[model samples]
Target: MEIMQSLTDGIMLGGIYGVISIGLSLVFGVLGVVNFAQAQFLMLGMYVSWTLWKLLGIDPILGIPLTGAVVFIIGYLIEKTLIQRILKAPPVAQIFLTVGLMIFLENAVLLIYGSSFQSVVVSYQSLGFHIGSLFISAPYLMAFTAAVIVCAGLWIFLSRSWFGKAIRATSQDSDAAVLCGINVKQVYALAFSIGVALTAIGGAVILPYMTVSPSVGGQFSILMFTVVVLGGLGNVAGALVGGLVVGIIQSLSTMVFPVQLQNLILFIVFIGILAFKPEGLLKEK
Candidate 1:
């Protein structure tokens, strides 16, 4: 029964994990750039939602779209101004650029919002339903449900929209896409924007359950990267699977490992995966 409960909770948590990490996969898929600052965008999303709630009384879940839109614009501008310049640069340059940006964003948020943690109260914040002996958290359930719905809509948008097709083509072969008049540069910006937007939405939905702080992004950065890598970098579908696996690992480990060691376990797994299955568990062996 304990194992069952852990599994259930893990799956619920994994849903949010998947949603937040999918953007990383998408960005790599389309732009071939690993965004080290992706977690900062998630932080930005949380702040956006928190601010909207504090000022206008809008619920975080209800403000997800708006949060996403705002983040998308910010991402677009950043891509155009900074990321684009590094697209053709060496991997070291790309990594440093994003890492630097991450530091900047973190400090900027700290300066603006202070270092204190902030959270929002919602009607369902403390609500939960019982399933036999298992208790399901309302916040987790709602966040998971919203993630699924959003992912479904995103899949449709990618498959049916012209821009989506263009993004896909660019991802496959930017040179070829350019020859086909796809405007690879524009597609790159669009893909980055969309990626960050998705992450922001995930952050917004999880706001009710999670506290927001300037440094919150530091906590999720490795976890998000782990999900993307486990799912196979640049594989959107793989992120979902990776997230579930990570969630389960995290949840079950709590039974045997100390709280401080949970991250050690994840780091060990991450190293093992890189050494043995760097292509990711979801990829064809």
Candidate 2:
């Protein structure tokens, strides 16, 4: 019974993970650039939601769209000013660019928001439902549900919208997309902006249950990358699956290992996946 509950909790956690990973995957899928700063945008969303809640009494869950919009603008401007310059640069240059951006953003937040941790208190924070002898946390369930909704929206936008089709075409071949009257540069910026916005939504949804600080990105960075890589860096469907697998691994590991050692197990799995399946489990052959 305990093990089953843990698995359920893990799936809940994975829902948020999947939402965040999808953004990362999309950026790579569209632009072919691995953004080390992606998690920082998650941190950014948390801060935005936290501010809105503290200042105007907005519920973090309810403020998800706003949070995503704010992050989307920031992402758009970033892609235009910084990421665009590196689109054709060496991969190493791209890595350094994003890593530098990550450090800068973290420090900028520290300067603006300080080093103190901030969390929101919601009515549902401690609420839960009892399914037979198992317990399901309300906040987790809410976050998971929100993630699913947002992911579904993303899928629809990517598959059915004109801009989304252009983005997909750009991802397939920027040159070909250009010949088809698509603005590849604009598509890159839009995709990256939307990607970060999605991640922001994940951050906003989880705010009721998680704390935020400038350094919060560090906590989830490895885990986020693990999910993306496991799902195949640019594969959206794979990210969702990887997220569930990672969440299960985390929950089940807790039954045997100490809490502090939980992430260590994840790291091992990440390394193993990279060593054996660099292309990821869901990558199309």
Candidate 3:
């Protein structure tokens, strides 16, 4: 029963984890850039949601669209102005640029929002339901539901929409996409925008269960990378699977390991995966 309970909690947490990591995967897929600053965009989304809740009395979950929109615009602009320039640069240059962006974003938020931690107070924050002996948390359920909806919407948009096809084509081969009459530059900007927006929505949904601080993105940076790498860096569907696996490992480990050692366990798994299956668990042949 206890193990079952942990599995349920892990699934819920994993859904949200998938949502957060998808953006990083998308950016790398389409742009071929390892965006070290992607998690900072998650932090930015949290701040946007927090601002809306503090000033307008909007619940963070309810403000997901607004959070996504705000971050989407910011992402679009950043990609156009900065990332576009480095699209064809050497890998080291791209890495340094993104790392610098990460530092700038973190310090910028610290300057603007200060060092205080913030969180939302929603009606269902502490509510939960029980199915026999397994209990489900309200915030976790809501966040997981939202994550599912977002993932489904993204899949439809990617597989059905014309622009989505263009994005996929660009990812497969940007030069070929251009020869096929697709505007590769526009696709890059839009893909980056959509990627970060999805992550921002993830941040919004989890506000009920998480506190926001300037350094919060740092907490999830390594975790996000592990999820994406575990699933395959550019594989979107793999990210969801990886998230579930990681979430389950995290939850079950807590039963036998100390809280401080939970991440240590995850790190071990991450290292093992990298050493044995660098192509990721879901890599295609």
| TM-scores, each model vs. reference | 0.97, 0.98, 0.98
Every candidate's lDDT = 0.92, 0.93, 0.92
Which runs of model 1 end up more than 4 angstroms from their true locations?
A: none
Give the lowest summed-lDDT range of ten residues in model 3: 276-285
Predicted structure 1: lDDT: 0.92
**Per-residue error at 284 for model 3, in Å?**
4.3
Ranking by TM-score: 3, 2, 1
lDDT tens digits, residue span 149-183, model 2: 99899889989999989988988889999999998
**Model 3 TM:** 0.98
Residue 196's lDDT within candidate 2 is 92
- TM-score of candidate 2 relative to the true fold: 0.98
lDDT, candidate 3, at 42: 91
lDDT of 1 by residue, 1-285 (tens): 999999998898888899999999999998989999999999999999999999999999999889999999999999999999999999999999999999999999999999999999999999999999999999999999999898898889889999988988888888899999988999999999999999989899899999999999888888999999998999888998898889889999999999788788889988888999999988722
